[model samples]
Target: MARFELKLPKMGESVAEATITNWLKQVGDKIEMDEAVLEIATDKVDSEVPSEVSGILIEQLFNKDDLVQVGQTIAIIETEGGDVVVAKQEATPIAVADVAKTVETAKESVSAPANFSDSDKFFSPLVKNIAKEEGVSVAELESISGSGKDGRITKEDLLNYIKNRGNQPAVAPIAIGTAPVVATQNVAPVAQKAAPVSVNGGDEIVEMDRMRKLISGYMVASVQTSAHVQSFIEVDVTNIVKWRNKVKDAFEKREGEKLTFTPIMMEAVAKALKDFPGMNISVDGDYIIKKKNINLGMAAALPNGNLIVPVIKNADQLNLVGMAKAVNDLGNRAKAGKLKPDDTQGGTYTVTNVGTFGSVFGTPIINQPQVGILALGAIRKVPAVIETPEGDFIGIRQKMFLSHSYDHRVVDGALGGSFVKRVADYLEAFDVNRDF
Candidate 1:
C-alpha cells in the first residue's frame, strides 16, 4: 500500500483559508472514496471535505479549530497500488549566524507568535501575527478581554487595545516553539463594555451562534461605515400581479420551476440598475468602482432564522424564465445550507422581500461597499380613484411600497430616489399578455 495526500480544495477565488470545525473520521478509520472526512468553515460558508481514494485514515495534519491554507495537505490516506515510497536524505542543521539573521529579519518584519502551536485558545492567523508584531505575549493576550463570541479576540479588539496601550515597552521576542508565556502584564481593556443585562432567575441565557455573531458584526460595521438614507414609493402592481397569476402555472409547467414574485421583482431591479448605472456602483475609500456586470444579490432567510445573500451573476442578461430558475435555485440551496462560497460573492446590488413575512415596509441597512439595497413591501389591495376620459370612479388596486436604502455619501437624493422610481415604473408597466 502507498500513501495518498488529502488536500483542502479551493472553495473560491477570494477564500484562502478555512477553520476546521469537525473531524468526521479519526485515525485508523476505514474510509470510502468520495466520503466526507472533515468539515470546514470559511468566512462565507461551511462545507465538508471528502476523501479522494478509499483507504484507512492514517493521519490528520490539523486539529479542530485550526486555520488551514488552501491546497495544503490536510490528511494522509493509505491507498492500494501505487509507487513505492522513498525516504529523502537528512538535511544539514542551520548555522548559528543564519539563525540570528533569521530572527533579526523576523523582528523587522512579521513573525509567528511564540507558543501559538501549544496554546489552547485559538488565535486567528491575523491576530497571532498582530500579536507578534506588537510584541504582545500570550499571557498578555489572555489578560485582555475579547469582544467577539465566546470571548475570542478579534482584530478590531486587538487593534483597539494596541492603540490605547500608550507608551508601553515592547516585550522581548521569546524563542519560537520553546517556553510557554510566563510574564503577565496589567493591560487596560480597550473594548467598550456593553451595558449589563439584568437576568431573571427563570430566564434562559443563550449565546449567539457563529453565523449570528458574524452577521451582527457585519451589520454594525455597515451602519458605522455608510451614511444611510431611505426613499419610499408606493407602486401600483395590479398589472404585474394579474400577469403572474395568469402565466405562473404555464411558466412552471414548461420551465420546471415555480414562477414567484421574487424573480419578477429581481428582473425589474436588474433593468433599473441598467438604466441608472450610477446606483450599481460600489465605494472604495475615495474612489468609486463601477461594476461592468449586473450581479444582483438576493437576500435569503435561512431555516435557522439567520440570513445569507446568494448572488446571481450577470442578472441583467437572463430572461424572465431564466431569472425565475436562478431565483428558485439559489433560494432552495440557501434554505438547504448547500450554497457554495462563490455563490455568496460578487454582488453589485441587493433586494430583500420583506413581504415574505407580512412586513408592509422596512428600512433595510445597506449591504456595504455596495451603495444601495431595495426592500419590497407586502402587496395589498387598496381602494383608489380611477380616472378616464368619461369620469372618475373608485376601484380596488394591488399596490406595494418600495423602500430603497442608500448610502447618502455617494448616492444623492436624486439618484437614490430615481433608481427606485425606475424599478416601480418597470413593474407598474409590466405587460399582462407577455409570453412566458
Candidate 2:
C-alpha cells in the first residue's frame, strides 16, 4: 500500500502555525478525497483542511488540541489498504514539581497560552478543572502541553486524552425501562437568588477573549504611539438620499447588486484620501509612511459577538458600484465566519458605522499605525433653511453627523476638519446618475 504523509497547508502570510481544534476521522477510519479531515485555528481565522486523497486513515501524527507548525506532517494515510503502521515517539517526562516551582518563581514573567489559562497558572483554569474532575494528577497533566493559553491544557486536551485511551470505550449510558419514565430531576437549579446587598457593590469577574485582549493591547499602544485628535461635521444627506432612492432600483438591476450607503461613503472617502494624501498614511517608528494606494478597511460586526475589519484592497481604484459590491460581499462573509486572514490586513484607513446601532455621534479610536478612522452616525430628519438665488426656504431634510478621529501626529486639526468637510460636501451634492 502506498502511504502518503499529509502536511499542514499554508493558511495565510502572517500565519505560521495553527492549533488542531478537531479531527473528523479517527485512525483506521476510511476517508474520501476532498473530505474535511480536520479544523485548525489560527490567530486571524479558523479553517478546515480537506483530505487530498481517498484512503484509510492509517495514523494521526498530531492529536487534537496540539499546536502544529505549518508544513508539518499532520497525518499519514495508506492508499492501498494494509496493516496501519503508527509512528511511536518517546514521551517527555513531566517534572510537575519543577514546573510548579517555575510558575511560582516566574509568575510575573510567565503568560499562559491564549486559549487555556491566565498569565499566572502553568495550567489554564479549564485544564486544571478538567484534571481535577478526571482525577488526573498534575504530573500527568504536565506531560500534555496546552493548545490554549501558552500551551496550557484546554477541554479538548482532556477529551483527546480520553479518546486516545484504547483500554476503555467512551460511551453514554442508555436508559432502559418498562415505559421509559424519564425523571425531570432538578439536579441543579436553573437560576440562583441574588445575594444580600452590601455597602460596596459585589464584584464580578469576566474572562476576555484573544481578540479582546489584542484589541486592548492595540488601543493602549495606539495612544502611546500617536497623538490623537477628533473632528466632527454635520451634513445634509437629503440630496444623496433622494438621488439614491431614485436610481437604486435601476442600478441594482443593471449591476446585479444592492446598493449600500457604505459604498457611497467609501467613494467620498476615497476621493478625500486622494485629495489629502496625509489621511492615507501610516505612522512608522520615527517617520510617516505615505501609502500610494487607498486600502479602506470596513469594520464589520460578527454574529457571534466579535468585531472584524476586512480591508477592500486598492479601494481607490474601484468605482462606486464596485465599492458597494465589495463591501456587501465582505460584510456578508464576515458575518458568516468565512473571512480569511488576507481580508483583514493592509488597511490604510478604516470606517466604522455606529449609526446602525442608533448612535448619533461617537469618537472612534484610531486603528493603530493608521492615521484616521471615520465614524458615521444615523441619519435623522431635521428642519433646516435652504438658501436659493431666488429666495430662502425652510424645510425638513434628512441630516447625519460624520465624525473623524485622526492621529494629530500626522494630520493636523485643520487638515482633518477639512477632509471631513470635503466628504460632507460630496455627500451633500451627490448626483445619482453622475456619482454611481
Candidate 3:
C-alpha cells in the first residue's frame, strides 16, 4: 500500500485559494479513482475535487469552511498500487530584484525552494521575488503580517511592509537594499470594535453570500472607476427572426444545438467589433489596450440567482454554427454550475440578454477593465413603414431595443453610438436565404 496526497488543484491564473464546503468522504471511506471526494467554492464557482487514484480515504487535512491553498495537500489516500503521481502545473512568475547585493543573499534566492514560505504561511512567487529584491530576510518576511486569502502574504502586504519597515529592527543589514532599522518604536493599540448585529422579532437579516458579496464589490468598483454613459438603438431584427424560424429545426438537426438569438446577435457584435477596434479594448490606468482578438462575454444566470459571464474566445472567428455551439455549451454549463474559472476570464467585451427576463432594454454595468457592455432587449412584433421603389406601406416587423453602455472616459459619443449602430445594421441585413 502507498499513501498519495490529494492536493487542492490550481483553479485559475488569478485564483489561489478556495473554501472547502463539504467533504463527501471521511477517513476510512471507500473511494474510487476519478470519483468526487470533496467539494469547494471559490469566488468564481463551486467545484468538486475528485480522487486521483483508486484508494480508501485515510485523512483529510482541511475541514469544512477551511480555506485551502492551491497545491496544498487537502487529503491523503491509501492505495494498493505503485506510485503514479498526478501531474500538476504550478504557477512560477520569475522576476529580478533590483538589489545591489553582497550577491550572496540574492544568489541564494535563485536556488530557493519553490515553497518559499517565510513561516508556516504560503507565499506566491511574485511575493517571494519582491522580498528577494527588497533584501527581506526570512525572519523579516515572517514578521510582517499577511492580508491575503487565508492570511497568505500578498504583494500589497509586502509593499506596505517595505514602506513602514524602518520602524522594525531585524537581522544584520545586507547593505545592498536594506532599510535603516530602528530598535525602539511606539505601537498603536486598538481601543474599541464595532458592535455586533442584534436581531429583533420580525427582523430578517441575512448575510450576503460569498458570490453575492464579490459581485457587489465588483459592480460598485466599476461604477466608481468608469465614466459611464449609454447609447440606445432600436434594431429591426425582422429578417433574423424570420431566418431563424425557417431554419432552426434544420439547423438543430444539422448542428445538434438550439438556435438562439444570442449567437445570431453575437455574430453581428463580433463583426461590428472588427469594424470598430476601439470598442474591443481595455483600460489600464491612463492607457488603452487595444485587443487583437475579439473575445465576447455572454452573460448567463446561475441557479443560485447570481450571474456569471463565460467568454467565447476569438468569437469573431466562429461561424454561425460554431457560435450556437459555444453559446449553448456555455449557457448549459453555467446553469448546471459546471463552468470552469478560465471560462469566466479574458473577456474583452460583454453582452447581456436582458430580453431573457422580458426587459425592453437596460444599461448594464461595464465589466471592469473592459470598456463596454451591450444589452439585448426583448423582441416584439411592431408595425413599421416599408419603403420600396414601387411604393411605401405599413408592415408588421420584429424589433428589439439595444442599450450600449460605455466608458465615456475613452469612448466618445460618435464612436460608441456608431459601433452599436453597426451591430444593428448587420442584424437588419441578415441573410434570410443563407444556409445554416
RMSD of each: 7.7, 14.6, 7.0
- How much lDDT does each candidate structure score? 0.82, 0.74, 0.82
Model 1 residue runs over 4 Å out of place are 82-189
Each candidate structure's TM-score, on Cα atoms with residue i matched to residue i, is 0.78, 0.68, 0.78
Q: Please give the distance, in angstroms, between residue 128's alpha carbon in candidate 2 and its true position after superposition.
A: 28
Once superposed on the true structure, which residue ranges of model 3 sit more than 4 Å away at CA? 82-200
Q: After superposition, how far is residue 345 of candidate 1 from its true place, in Å?
A: 1.2
Q: Which tens-of-lDDT digit does each residue in 1-436 have in candidate 2?
A: 8786777776555455677888988999999998888888765566677788888888899988787766778999888655544333233222244333433433243223333321233453334434443445443454454554223466666657644644433222224553322122312222477897555457765689656765676677577666878889999998788888888998898999888788988889988899999789987655779998899999998766778889999998998888989999999999887787678878999999989999998888888769999999998999999899999999999999998999887799889999999999888878756746
Per-residue lDDT of candidate 3, residues 157-255 (tens digit): 777777677666654432557763423343224348879878899999889977888789779768988889999999999889888999999988887
RMSD of 2: 14.6
Q: Count steric clashes of candidate 3.
A: 0
Kindly report the root-mean-square deviation of model 1 from the true structure over all alpha carbons: 7.7
Model 2, residue 338: distance off in Å is: 1.0
Colliding residue pairs in candidate 2: 112-149, 113-149, 113-150, 114-149, 115-149, 116-148, 116-149, 146-151, 146-152
